[model samples]
Target: MIKDRQLYKLILSILTVIVVAMIGLQLVSSWTQPQAQSQLNLYESDLLLQASTWQETNDAEPGTSPLLENLWGDSDPVQQALKNYQKIKTSATLQSGPTDDPEKRAASEAFVNELDLRLGLLYARSGQVEDAIATWTPLAEAAPSPGNQRAVTAAILQGLWSDPPQLKPQAQQQLESQLKGWFRYQSLSQLYQLQQRQETLTTLRSQEHAAAEKALTRLAAVQVFPAIGGLTGVGILIFWLIQFAVKKRQSLPEAASTAPTIEPIEAQADQTPNTPQELAATVRWPVTTIWQVMVVWFAAFFCVSFVLPVVLYVAGAKPETFGARGQAYLALIQYSLLMGVGFSILYLSLKPFLSQPLKWLPLRWQGSWFSWGLSGYLAALPLVIVISVLNQKLLQNQGGGNPLLEIILNSHDRFSMGLLLFMVAVLAPLFEEILFRGFFLTSLTRYLPMWSAIGLSGLVFAIAHLNLSDILPLTVLGCMLGFVYTRSQNLLASMLLHGLWNSGSFIGLIILGSSVS
Candidate 1:
């Protein structure tokens, strides 16, 4: 008995050490290799611009005036510009045209920057000034040269102060403060030139007759989400209330008299395995069984995300259209709450099922909160992105990208920014990680060799997304998440890291969107 106890302790200690070491490695890796935020924004902006080019070409014929009006009038300038860029880029590349020269490239970039700036101004007109600033800050920083810098800065400041006189004084002070710090290192000649140009624009700002009129026109074209946010909150509250009510009813005397359920108690005595071989055998099947369960769960997840929406449409419930930022915020809260509830239940139930084929999955923890959450976050990031991208591609190919998503991306609306944030950062990351990394990745490690566990998780994660377009991205991310989770042995770590990566990507895209043409 003593030998068995000692053997179990040794195995647990070794696993714990390995998990911690893996987490530390991931932390170091993530810290050292931040995403190329600028490049990512460029890619997204370029993609949007390409899409816009298609509409422009289709709208050029004299007889197609109504179509052009429909396209331009219905779509916000940002969406129209994005689609224009996308179409032009894609069509030109498809036709084997020579790439534009550096000057044209610079011009194109400037156009994109201006479009994003205009969009930011529209957002500000909609009372989302903070978002506008977030969107434009990078444009000001990344202006091509002194001329471009002045143009962008003047445009930004002019937009800020042009709104209302009350808004102008505060905006002018802020703009001046920002410029002072930014130009401190520049040569006197350059500063003088920029200041002269800025003064001219500031004088124009007082008129507010053209730019504000344009901004108002664009703002009128922008659309926001309806009541989904309120509905979601109410739905969640109702779900919890019903759960609590059920438990209270079950505890009543009438309910107790009819049901003869046994209340489980913790075992006071230790129940060590009889031998080393027994201990090993006891863990193996549970790991295998849990992995199979997770596989089924993931497969079902693909259906839920990709296929079920179609079913819902057929059944008459429209896929809920939501703003990107709102969706992301809700997802962050929802996933965190789900994780807390899920792990808590698993931990409480784990002991009663020690002899069943589920003991290998650890709901119980023996580590500090920091280490555990760190492990979970580090382990989950890659897997989440990979799975989501793959799933998105699959849905796209099937013409199953939510009709609302297609509308949001393709239509001109005030909510496009919000939708982009949700898709890339919030919804995709949360669902993918919880299904794959939080469950299957850790469970597989119980029986398989560590490398095998990570590989298996990656393989399953990739396949579950159900599209070739996403396979590469998802596989790479899944492997990274598996490695971190196995190393850290903590779900919390994976969740935090995963959430951070997603949010970071969204923020980076917004920053780049400001500058990319």
Candidate 2:
């Protein structure tokens, strides 16, 4: 017992030393690197000029569209343009105060109107017609100034006429109403008559019919599967909730009648193996010791996940060039080092508390490992699909994209792709499972019920990624990992499931990038 206690202390000391060393290295790197270049100031004229150039060079090839390039490429001129437009519009809105000088107020409003017109045009040219309409609709409707209304109306008309005609009846009616209102307000009867031409309405109706037929055909091809999958998931959840409520109600009566009593020595004997060797082989450390191990485990996790990224950022190590293999190599090295350090900390901290540390760590292979892993993988597929669809819709609504995924897609090369595959599919699965499912879930089970422990561990696992957008889906995945680990009592089962999940995503990314290229 004395030796065991000393060994535990020594293990903790070693883990502490490793963590401190990592922090020191990060600090040294941050201090040694040179400062980054200052950002350039961009104006509306510059952005418009850039947009014009991009549009001129835009290719119809899958990945060659200037808008896509700017969205996913290293130097994002289009995003910068959008940002500048937003900043100018915000400043103008704030500066146009009721008490301000008349000249200043007029200048502010003028700039805001011009900026909105240019922004609407840019969005239309970039093939975002909805966004263009969204930009111009309010300006055309709410602004009382005739000049502002005219400028916005012209831009909206130009956008509607430019491409794939905006032929939806609602869109057309809304625009026509705004146009009629503007014409009546300004007494521009000639302009209104031209817009009301029968030929124009006939052409727009034809375009709308064609577009609707194409959309309906495409929707008919694969719409049924998603509807069925969504309904199935909802049904399963409802059934489970009802069953849980019924079980709880039934259990209350049993709990009220039963009185707890001590078990006989024979019953205790039956729970354990007979021989000392067998007892040593099967015994696990007390739950308290597992919790103690987690303190060190999480410390190492934070050091890598948070501190290391800050160090890399300050060190000017971020790669600026798309498809730069050097960045891939750097990422692999960073991930490897971090995983090694974290695993060492977990293993060392937990070892002394168990008689057979490897078995107690649940590292031993089980006969049913493959079966459990396969089942878990199969179960994860529907959940992954549901979450991915929801996330895509959310991103589309926000007009946002995933920077990390964009980087990965842009950085495609033979060596870099292979390295990414290994890091994501193999290293990530092994180390992440060991930390989250093996250690964290086990530790939580010491104090909480098994299901509650699984939930809390899953939440922590999601939080560890440090990505708010990914938390919900990642938490769902983590819970699945925990369930597999608990059911199989084998870490390898969870690791296998994790590897399969990541491998599928990595392969999909590669395929998508290839198609785009």
Compare the candidates by lDDT and give the number of the best one.
2
At residue 262, what lDDT does model 2 achieve?
A: 21
lDDT of 1 by residue, 290-389 (tens): 6334433433333344554576568875535544544444444444544444444444434545554233432234555355444444334434544554
278-303, model 2: which lDDT tens digit per residue?
A: 22223244544564565576566666
**Model 1, 177: alpha-carbon shift in Å?**
30
lDDT for model 2 comes to: 0.54
TM-score against truth, every candidate? 0.38, 0.49
What RMSD does each model have against the real structure? Answer: 20.7, 14.9
Separately for all candidates shown, the number of backbone clashes (residues 3 or more apart, or on different chains) is 40, 0
Give candidate 2's total backbone clashes: 0
| Model 2 lDDT-worst window of ten | 251-260
Evaluated at residue 315, the lDDT of candidate 2 is 84
